[model samples]
Target: MRQPSRQGVEQALDRVMRVVTRTPLLPMGHGGAQAWIKAESLQRGGAFKLRGAYNRMVQIAPEDRPRGVVAFSSGNHAQGVARAARLLEMPAIIVMPADAPAVKLAGTRALGAEIVTYDRATESREAIAADLAARRGAVLVPSFDDVDVVEGQGTAGLEIAAALGHVPARVIVPCGGGGLAAGIALALPDAEIVVVEPEGWDDMRRSLELGHIVEVPADAPPTACDALQSRRVADITFGALHAAGARGVAVSEAEIRAAMRFAFAHGLVVEPGGAVALAAWLAGRLTDDGAETVIVCSGSNIDPAAFAAVLQEEK
Candidate 1:
């Protein structure tokens, strides 16, 4: 498929609004800087994944609807595709990490999708999902690599810009496989796109810096941000981000925890992966660049015990 464009994103916004919630743009400030939070954490399915999932699944050929679809996700995207498929009255199968968050796994099951668990350390979710799709003659809806999905995610940027009456000076998004960042970059050409990833999973960051794709280190350390654990970015996403002149930052575990706590204090509940952009901002990793920035708080489906511990750690 072709790279997502502004027109494609506009079309996606129209379709996505039919099913997804238009999350609000909230104002927040720290030190001398002010920002608008694109609170996608409030979206249906508890994350922005619903936008892309619905947009892609809804467009499946009417004749092929009975065949359903297959996907792979650690959490958020699983819920997205499952929920969408449920709404479409189609069967859905999700290949998920065996150790994925309980809340996420429960959410996917609740949405009526079959769950196929795999060992993240040993098994390839892609290979498994592909095989399932081939076996069932089902459509494979990629989490980030597909053009339709990218366009759907970009609707967030459209909403943000429309709310602000113009493109903000900057937009910071949490990155996994670079879908959201790439989409936002296309949506707001005038704004600087800043992608934030967990420290050890900063393949996109390094890839951008090195001007080529880079896979996550084989011995990468554990991270709480399971939703952002993409091993590498697809060429489609990287091409859009690179063309948009995007920048990147990596957030530490402590920083992500602090951001989660900070968001909670502000009456927003954010997952570890979802809070990375805000984490970078809170940790002073993002300098005062004189831009009216917008940070995407991407998801909210965090496990209760883990959230409580992060909040308690500071107290």
Candidate 2:
């Protein structure tokens, strides 16, 4: 069977629109240049992950649905997959890092997914998820590397272009596994793509520099946001980034906290990982290249305590 394409991603915008909210494209007037933000944090389950999760879930073979589904996520992906599976009435087993945010861990459970937590500093979530799939006979849904997932994520780009009514000169996306940025880059080849990462979780940055996916240490002297916790780079996203001539930037955790405070002051609620792109903008990471810019506002599943603690620590 033929795989889904860019056109399919476009059509899915309409299909998903019925279930998922058509998040707004608002201007980042605070930052110079015509920066429009794709507020994906407003999606169901508090992140854009739901878009791909539902798009991919709704298309699963009916015969294959009974075997159930399995996935590994740090936070947003787990919640998105769990929520999508619940809607389909399929059993879901989600593997998460033991250090996953309380909000994400609880959110996935609330969505009725069975929880399997592993050591983040030592264990491999891939191995855990793979084993879960083998034992349960479930389909493993990779957070960002699968075509279905990538196609689903591309819908964000489609909507951004449509909403903006024209292609932008540049687009900024926060990178964890690089799926979101890759999806946008794939869909909008006409635009320049830059990835903003928490200073330490710069996997894509280091990966592109090395010309291959390389593992980056998580606690290698940690700073910056939560939810940017990723250890591997994905081929699915790397291909898109390379094709789009993408660049990378790193933002300090202090800068991210300042940006986060600015967002909250402006009535925007964004998690640390999701706020990296905006944080990059606030830190003056881009030039006014006459390119209409769009930043992916990806998620908002915040742990109440961490939120308060970060605010206090930053203060």
Candidate 3:
């Protein structure tokens, strides 16, 4: 039940810097309002997940590292952990949804991690991962539930602050299990934190509005954002975001698609989930009051065919 702190994020930044690349903060403008995009879509492992994944695994004791690690992610976290484990020379077993995007599945596999497919609807990935870890005597690394992971994810926020040479007035982030959003909240205590999610899957939005954690509906509609389909928000993430006075918003599918197109137009490839924050901004769901803002472009792991179809729609 340890809470992530700014100090921990700083330490994590120092540790992850050895492996995590410093992605660019691209300048962008829309409707006369200006913002910076933290293109984590260019990060190693194609997302910011590597920062947390590496920070968590690198802390494992030498005696325990040999047993390897077990984790469950829709896709991004799987690749992150797999890449980190590969760097650390430790084995990784990822429990992934059977229907995860082929690009993500292939990416994790290519990184040399063993994948265990699961039925996301009828089965519990957490249970599968826990049992797998217990049976194999491996460590369990929850995507957003671990303090180390949250702290590690905060490194991006630290970089944002450092690059801007001052704290931004606001930061917009895509929320899955709320890991990245919560991490940024801890990193930029004075900044306004805005968490965005796909419409039907905005449990975190409802949770913050209700002042309690809530589960995604059993009948939530399908979304292209496989990476943001987390069923529930973790206490660790919820606590940090709630304490930071963070607010949440949900964007429509059309908005997400539009944001992806916007990123592409800007010469960046952003997956649907990664574009939700930009979606919110572009759709004017959040007011652009001229304050300095940073919109996080979190990932870019879309399947080529699917991405092509999306692009074709614009043509």
Candidate 4:
């Protein structure tokens, strides 16, 4: 597949803006440091996934739409595809991990998509989704690997630049399969890209450091960032980020929880996965040289109980 381009991202922005919400770019200051938060957590479907999902589904050929679409995601992407399919009047089947948070499962189901659950530790979600799509003659919409999806996700970067009136010196994005980071890199070519991931599942970080794709360790510790738990980094996403000279950092569970609290204190709701970028920033993993910076608050789909518990933790 061809690599996504800025032109492709621009085209995707035009297509997605009609459906995706233009989330806010809020200013945040810590001590003497100032940064802007791209509040994608406030986006429709409670995440930025909708931008790419809608962008991809909207392009399905008319005749092909009848076959519908199939996808695999822990939760955010499932809801994204489900919402997009509903908007486009297409059937959607989502293969999700059985252990995904109840809120995410319920959210996706509420959007009217058929759900297929599998064991994340023992089964491959990609295999299941691909098989289901092949059998049903439906389109397989990957969470982050497709060119259109990457371009669609890039629309967020476009919005960031447009809001700032110039490219920020840097952008910190949470890394899952690297779609958001890659997309933003393409969108803000002049800015430095930094990806943040959960400590045990920092495959993208390791891949960037090693100059090759790397898979998360088989015995990786469990993390609360379910949305950022891709076992391997995809070539498409890695390629885009590597070319953009992106760097990465991994944050601990404690740091993620703290970041969530920080966001809440600021009147924003952030999921664990979505809070990693902010965690990195708050933990001093990334320096603030007074250069303009943007940190993406990617999602806000945590269950009420889970979010409450995190908020109650001591700082």
What are the per-residue Cα lDDT tens digits for candidate 2 across 124-210?
889999998998889999888787787778888888888878888888999988878887887787888999888767879887776
lDDT of 4 by residue, 1-315 (tens): 578989999999989998899999999988778899999999999999999999999999998998999999999999999999999999999999999999999999999999999999889999999999999999999999999999999999999999989999999999999999999999999999999999989999999999999899999998999999898988999999999999999999999999999999999999999999999999989876877889999999999999999998877
Q: Cα lDDT for residue 204, model 2?
A: 90
Each prediction's TM-score versus the true structure: 0.99, 0.93, 0.99, 0.99
Give Cα-based local distance difference scores for all models.
0.93, 0.82, 0.95, 0.95
Off by over 4 Å in 4: none
lDDT-sorted candidate list, best first:
4, 3, 1, 2
Number of backbone-clashing residue pairs for each candidate, in the order shown: 0, 2, 0, 0
Q: How many collisions between residues are there in candidate 1?
A: 0
Minimal lDDT window, size 10, model 2: 1-10
Give per-residue CA lDDT, model 3, range 49-114, as digits (tens).
999999999999989988999999989999999999999999999999999999999999999999
Weakest 10 consecutive residues, lDDT, candidate 1?
Answer: 306-315
